[model samples]
Target chain A: MTDQPWIAVDAMGGDEGLEVMLAGVARARRRFEGLHFYLVGDEARIRAGLHSHPNLSANSEIVHAPEVVGSSEKPSQAIRRSKVTSMGIAIDLVKQGRAAAMVSSGNTGALMAMAKLSLRMLPGIDRPALAAPLPTLGDNDVVMLDLGANTEVDARNLVQFAVMGAAYARVILDLDRPRVALLNIGSEDQKGTDWIREAAAELRAATHLPLDFTGFVEGDKLARGHVDVIVCDGFAGNIALKTAEGTARFVGDLLKRAFTSSVRSKLGFLISRPATQLLRDHLDPNNHNGAVFLGLKGIVMKSHGGANELGVATAIANAAKMARADLTRRIAEDLGLEHVA
Target chain B: MTDQPWIAVDAMGGDEGLEVMLAGVARARRRFEGLHFYLVGDEARIRAGLHSHPNLSANSEIVHAPEVVGSSEKPSQAIRRSKVTSMGIAIDLVKQGRAAAMVSSGNTGALMAMAKLSLRMLPGIDRPALAAPLPTLGDNDVVMLDLGANTEVDARNLVQFAVMGAAYARVILDLDRPRVALLNIGSEDQKGTDWIREAAAELRAATHLPLDFTGFVEGDKLARGHVDVIVCDGFAGNIALKTAEGTARFVGDLLKRAFTSSVRSKLGFLISRPATQLLRDHLDPNNHNGAVFLGLKGIVMKSHGGANELGVATAIANAAKMARADLTRRIAEDLGLEHVA
Candidate 1:
C-alpha cells in the first residue's frame, strides 16, 4: 500500500450533510495512523466541524467548492455544470492523482456520472455497475452487481457485470475464481428472457475467463450463498436488494415486538442478548457498508446516503482497501479495455 | 358452516402422494370433530391405509379416480382427458352439490384449468386471479392477488383484482372497506407504465366501490400493512411473493444457526422458547395457507403442494369459509360483471 495519506471525501453530499461525513472521516483517521482526509466541501462548514478535533484537524485538509449538487439534480447536468461541487471535486482529485481513491455518500447518479466523466470507464467496459457485498445465510457474503445503476441492460452487459463482479470478489473479498451466477426467476437454463438465456449461453461458452461461471441462480439462492457473485440488470437487482432490506427490517421489527411482549419474555430476551446481538450484527446493513461503482478507472465507493458515522467509516475503509489492492490496474488488465472504442 | 359431515379431497394430487394426503386428512379429521373426508384416489390403497383406523374407514368414503394428473401435464389437456382424475372429480363433486367445496393440494395449473373449465368464471369476470392473505406487520394480513395465474394483464384486470381481493378480505377477515392499493415501484401518481397509471386513475375515481382505494403502494409497504389489498400483474406478484418466501426462509435458517452457536446461547434459546415459538407462529407460511383462485363460479383453493397436513387443513378451512361466505356472489356484485360483458 502506498504511504500517501490523503483520501478525498465528498462532504457536501448525503442526507445528513457535512457533519456526518466529517465525523466519519475523523473517526476513520483516528483508527488508521498516517491516514489524512481531503474534505471537499464549503470551507466554512468543513472548518467548523474540524475545529473541535485537533488531532483530525492536524491531518485533514479542506478543499473549498462553491456550489453543492442537490440530491434531486439530474446527474448529467450536475456533472457538466458543477465542476466546483464537492462530489465533482472529489472525482477530480482521483483524476489528478491528488488522492488514491474517492468516497461519496451523495446522489448515486451524480457519483457515477462524475466518476465516469472524470476518471473514464476501464477499456472494455460498456457501462459501469455498482456492486455491494450482501450478507447471506452462509458464513461469507455474496457480491451482487448493478444495484440500480443501469435500468435497462442487454446480454453482453450482464456478462460484463459478471466478469467485473468476479474480479471485485477476488480483489476485495480475496476469492479465487469466484463462482458467478445470473439472477433469474428459476435456475433452469431457459428460465428467463431472451437476453438472459443468451447471456447464459455466452458465459458457458467463454472458457478463457479467470472466474468459475455458474449458470443461473434463483432469488431464493441469494441468501443461501450458493454463488459468490450474483449478476443481473439494475432493475431486477434493485428490486431484489430492496426486497431483502424490507424483509430484514420486517423480521427485526417483529423480533423486537416479540421480545418486549411480556415480563417473562423480556427476561428471556435479556438472557439471550448475546445471541440476538450476533444475529443483528450479521444482518446489519451498516456493517456491509460500501458499494463500489465498478468498471470505472478509479476507486469510487458510495456509502448509503442515510448511513451514520460507523457506516461512513466502513466506506472509508473499503475505499482504502480497494486502492491498496490496485483495483483499477487489475480491471484495466483483465478486461483488456485498451482494445475498446 | 354447512352441516355436511364429509368434504371430498383430491388425494391423488400434490407432489406428496396418497399416503401423505391421507395422513393429513386423518390428522385434520381427528382434530376437527364431525369432519369426515371423501378421499378421492385409488380405492384399494385408500382402503389398505384405512385398515388400521376403523373410525377413519367408517367416517370417510373413497371415490376411485383411476388416473392422476402429473404436475408437468398441461392443465387444459389434463382437464380434457382425465375425467376421473382426482382434481377433476373433486371439482365435479362441488359442481353437483355433493360437497360444500373441494380441496386440492395438487397441480395448481390443473386445478385452475379444471376450475375455470368445469366451474366456469363468475359472470362478467374476464380472468380469474389467485388471491392469498399474507401476514403483515399489523394485526391483519394483506391480500395479494394474481400470484402467477395470469402473466399478461391490462388495467381493467388490475381493477378487477382489487375488487376480488377487497371482497375476499371482507368475507374472510371481516374488514370494512379494506384499504386497496395498486402495487408499483413508486407511490407517485405518475410512476408506472401507462396501463398502471390509467388503472390508478380509475381506482382513484372509483366512488361507488366499497373500498378505501388508497393510491399506489411500493413492495416494502406490503409487509408494513400500509394497505390491505395489493393488486399487481401475475408476473410481478409471483416474483414478489416468491422473493418474500425465499427471504423469510433464509433469515429463519440464519437465526436457527445463530441461536444454536454455543452452549450458553442454546441454553438461552431454551429459556426463550415461548417467544421463539410466537415468532415462528407469526412467520409460519403454513398458518397463512391456501391461495384462492378468485373470480371463478365455484370455490377452488390451491394449497402448496409441499404443504404438510396442517397446510392442507388450513386450505380446506379456507375453502369452507369461501363457500360459507358465498364469495362468488360478492365478487360478481363488486365487479359489476353483469354490466361489463
Candidate 2:
C-alpha cells in the first residue's frame, strides 16, 4: 500500500460523458488528499471538461484514447474492435502497473469482460465475483457478492466466494472476524439445494479462514444490520438486491403519493422533511455506488452508469480505499496463494 | 364452478392453535356465504374452538385427527409417522373427494411433501409449483410461482410453471389475457442462463396459450401491476418473495423511526394518520396471506405458519375463491389436458 495511489478513471464512460466524470474527479480529489489520477480519454475534450476544475487538472494526467465504448456495445465487439476505447485503455493501465486501481461506468458486461481479460484472475481464483456494499441498519455496510458476475456457481465456486468475500469484508468493514452467512430461503441445515449444503460443509471444515461461519441466513435478514457478508450465487444475489431496491422505491413512491393527496398531509411532509432526508440519505443508492470486481489480479471498481457526480466521487473514493488497503493481497493470502504484489 | 364449495381446514396446522383456526373460519364464512368447512384436528379441541364460533359451527363439521406434525420435523419423517396429523388429514380429505380444497399453515416442506404424495400431480404436469398472489400497484395482484417447490427446474418445467401461473392469475386477478413474463435480472433476451432463455424461446413459440407473453421482466417490475404473472425457478422465486417482504417491512420500520423521532414529526404523523393507514394496509402481510400450491389434483393454499386470525381468514377466502373458480380445470385445459372438473 502506498500513501499516494494513482487511480485510472475512464473519462468517457457512464451515461454522462467527460464533464460529469471530471467534476466527480475534482470532488473526489478534495475528499481524499495525496491522490493522483490517470484521466483516459480524448485529450482535447478532457482539457475542455477540466476547465471548471483547476485542482483536478493539476492532479490528473491525460492518456489519449481515440474511441469510446457505447452503452449498448457487446463485450466481444468492444474488446475486438475498440481496443483503444477509454474503458479499455484505463483497464490496460492497471495491468501495466501505472495505476493502482481502475474505475469505469461503461457497459457492465463489456467492462467486466475487458477487465477480466486484461488483468486476468488471481492464480487460485477460477472466476472473479462482482462485490458490492449494501446499506444495512448498522454503522458498517454489509458486503454482498457475485452480484450478477457468474449466475451459476458450483459447490467449490461457492466455497471460493466465501473465502473471497471474507477477505473483502475484512478490508471494507475493518473487522478482524466478520460474521459470514450463506443466503437461503430457510435457515435450517436441511433446507436449500445440495450445492449450498455441500458448500456449508466445506466452509465448516475450512477452520483456517478468519471468518465466523454462522450457518444460514434468510433474505429477510440481509438488511437486519447484523451479518457482515451475505453469500449467494449471482442469480439469487441479483434478484435479492434488485428486489430490495425495487420495493424501497415502490414504498418511496407510495409515500410521495400519500403525502401529496391532500393539504394536511402535504404540510405534514414538509414538517417531517428533516426526518425524511435522513431516511433518504440512508437508503440512497449514491451513498453505496461502487461495486468492485474481486478475484482479479488488479482492483477494478464499477460505478453505476446512471450515477450522479456525487455517486461517481463515492465510487472513486471507494476504489482509493480498497487500493490503499491492498484488498487484492488480502484475498491472495486468504486463499493460501502467494501474494501477487 | 360449485355454489357450495366444501373446503378442509387444518385446525392445528399454524403457530396459533385451534382457537385461531376456528376464528379465521368464522371470519372467512362471513366473507363467503354458503361455504362449508371440514375442520380436521383433535375432536375435543375442535369442539372447544367451535364454541366461540357459532356461525362457523353451524356450517362446519369436525373430523378427528389425533397426531400433529412438529414444525421442525423433516418431510420424510412426518410422512412415515404422522398420516393422521391435522395437515395430513386435511390433504387426505381433498384427495378422498370429501373437500374441494384444503388450507394449511403448517410446516411448508412437510405440507408440500405430504400434499404431492397424497393428491398427486395434474394430468399433464410433471411437478407442482407453488403459486401466490403478490400485491401490485393496480386493483389486482400479480401471481408469482415456483416459489420453493422445485429449487432447480429445467426449461420444460419453467414453461409448465408459466402455464400454471397464467391460469392461476386469470382466476385470481380476473383478467382475460394475463400478461406473463419470465423473472430475470434483466428483460433482455441474453440476460440469464440457458434454462431461462430456452424457456423464453418456448413460451414465445407457444402462441396457442391464452396469456400475453411479455418477454422477460426484471425483479423491480414484479410490483409494477402491469405484469399478471412472474415465473422463475423455486430458488429465485423464494428469494424474491422473501426479499420483497423484508424490504417492505424494512421501509415500514424506517417510517416508524422517522415519524417518532421528534415532537413535530410525531404531530405530523397524527395529521397524516389516514395516509399512513393506507400504506400499512397496502404492505400488510395479513392482507396477502394465501400462497397456493398449483398443478396439484386439488387446490392447497399454504398460509404463513405464524399468521394471525386475519391472515388465516385471508387464506381460507383465497381457497374458497379458487375452489369456486375451478383453478385446476383451467390449468388442465391450458396445458391441453382434459379439464378435470
Candidate 3:
C-alpha cells in the first residue's frame, strides 16, 4: 500500500454528473497526499472538467467509457451490458488489479451487480454484504451490515456477515476485536426466527473467530453503540436503517415548528443557533457518506446517489483508507479464506 | 357500548406497581365521566391504595388474585399459571363479559398469551396481531399492526392484519376507508421476499375491502402520514417501532446536550424553554400511549411498562374510547366473522 495507489472513479455516474464527481476527487486528492485516480467515463467530458483543477488533473488519467447504467435498470440486464458502462469498467479496473479500489455514487443495483460479477465472491463466502457506519451515542460509530445486498439470509449467511462486519470494523474503526451482535425483534433468547437463533448459537460457539458475540440486541439499542458490529438479513437491516432516518427527520420537523411558533422563540433560536448548528452537523447523514460492499474480491464503496461534493469526498477518503488497509485480504483472513488468496 | 362500561385494569402489573395503576385509573375516571373500573389484583392492597381517591373507589371494584407473572417468564410458562395472575384474570374479565375491555402494563408476552387463550381468535383470523398508533406529520396518526404478536406471518395473515388495522383506524381515527400500505425494505415491486410480494399482489387485487391499498411504503416514509394503515409481520413491524423510538430518544438527548453547552445558549434556553418543552411533550412516548392487541375476541390494550401516571391515564382514555366504539365487534364485522359472534 502506497500513498499513490490508484483509486478508480465512475465519472459519468452519480446525481450531478462529472462536475461534482471531479470536484470530490480533487478534494480527496488534496487531503490525501500523492493520491492517484483513474477516472472511468467519457474522456472528453472528464478532461474538460479536470482542466479546472490543475493539481487533480496532473495526478489523474482518464479511461473513456461510452455507456452508463440507469438507476431503473434491472441487475440482470445491467450485468449483460457491464462491458460498456462507466460503472462497469471502473469495477473491471479493480478486478484487473490496475486499481486498488472503486468508488461510485451511481445506480446502486447496477454497481452491486457489476462489482459482484467482475470481482466474484471470496472463498467460503456465499454472498457479499453492504455495510455502513451509523452514528451512535458511543465514542465511535457502529458498523451495520447486509443493508440491502441479500434479502433473505440463512443462519450460515448471518454468521458470514458477522465475520465480514467484524473485519471491516477492525480496519475502518481501528479496533483489534469488536463486539458483534445479531439484530432481532427482541433481546430475549427465543424472540426471533429459527435462522437468527441458529446464527446466535453458531456465533456463541465460534471459538476460532476474534469476535465477542453478544447474544441479541433489540432495534432500539442500535444507535446506543454498546456493540461494534450489528448483523442482520438485508430486509430487516434495510428497514431499520430507513426507519431511523425517518425518525430523525420527524424530530427535526417538530423542532422547527416549535422554534418558529412565536417571536420570542425566534429570537431565542437565533441566540442558540450555534449550539443547534453543532447538533445539526452531527445528525446530518452527509457526515457519514460511505457504505462499502464487504466480502468482495476488491474494495467497492457506494456513495449516496444524491451526495454533494463533501459527501463524495468522504466516500473517497473511506475508499482510499480501505484500499490502503487491504480490507478484502483482511476479510479473507478472518473467514479462514487466507489459503484461497 | 356505554361510556360507563366496566374496563379491567391490571393493578399489580407494571414497574410502578399498584400505586401508579390506581392513580392512572383515578385520572381516567376524572377525564371520562361514568367510567367503571374492574381492578384485578390483591383486594386488600387495592382497597388500601383506593383510600387516597374516594372518586375512583366509588367507581371501582376489586377482583382478588395472588399470582403474578415475572417479566422474564416465557409465554408457555405463563399459560400454565393463568388462572391466578392479575394480568390473566384481567383478560378473563373481558372474555366473561364482565368488562368491556382490558388494559395492562405488564409482561407483554404473558398478557398476549393469556388473552389469546381465554378469548380465542376471531373467526377467519388465524392469529391475533398487535397494533398501535404512531405519530406522523399528517393531521392524524398512522395505525401499524403485528408489532410482535406473531414472529412470522403469511400473505393471508398480512391481509387479515390490514382488515383489522383499517377497522381500528376507522374507530380510533374516525376514518371511513383508511389508506393501507405494506411496509417493505423498498418500494419496488421486485424488492422483498415472496411472502410480501404475494401479499402486495393480493392487496392490490382486493376490490371488496373498503381500504385503499397504496401498494408499498419503505420504512422511512412511515411518519410521512400519507399512508394510514401500515402492515407487516411481527418481526419487521417490531423492529420499525423500536427503531423509531430509539432514534427519537437519541435525537432528543443530543438536543438537550446542545442546549446546555454554553452560557449564551443557556440564557437562550431559558427564553425558549416553553418552546422546547412543547417539542419534548410532542416527542414523549406517553402521549402516544396505548398499543392494542388486535384480532382477539375482545379488546386488550398494552401500556408502556415504565410509563408515568399521565402515560397510564392516556392508555386508560384510549381503552375507554375503544370500548365505547366496540372495536372488537367492528373488527369482527370487517373480517365477516359477525355471524359467528
Query: lDDT score, residue B91, model 1?
Result: 85
TM-scores for chain B, listed for all candidates: 0.93, 0.97, 0.97
Weakest ten-residue segment in model 2 chain A by summed lDDT: A332-341
Cα displacement (Å) at residue A206, model 1: 2.9
In model 2, residue pairs whose N, Cα or C atoms come closer than 3 Å (at least 3 residues apart or on different chains), thus clashing, are none
Model 2 spans with C-alpha error above 4 angstroms: A337-341, B337-341
For model 2, residues B174-246, the per-residue Cα lDDT tens digits are: 8888899999987778889899999999889877788888998888778988788999999999999999988
Model 3 clash pairs are none
For residue A114, what is the lDDT in candidate 3?
84
Report how far residue B172 has shifted in candidate 1, in Å. Answer: 2.3
lDDT of 3 by residue, A229-307 (tens): 9999998999999999999999999889988999989889999999999999898887888899998899999998888
Give the TM-score comparing model 2 with the true structure, all chains together. 0.97
Candidate 2, residue A26: how far the Cα is off, in Å: 1.8
A207-290, model 1: which lDDT tens digit per residue? Answer: 677788888877667888778999987756766777777887898888888878887778777877888798888778878888
- Per-residue lDDT tens digits for candidate 2, residues A143-260, read 9988888899998888888888989999988999888889987989988989999999877877667888988988887888789998899989989998998889988888888899
Reference-based lDDT, each prediction: 0.81, 0.88, 0.90
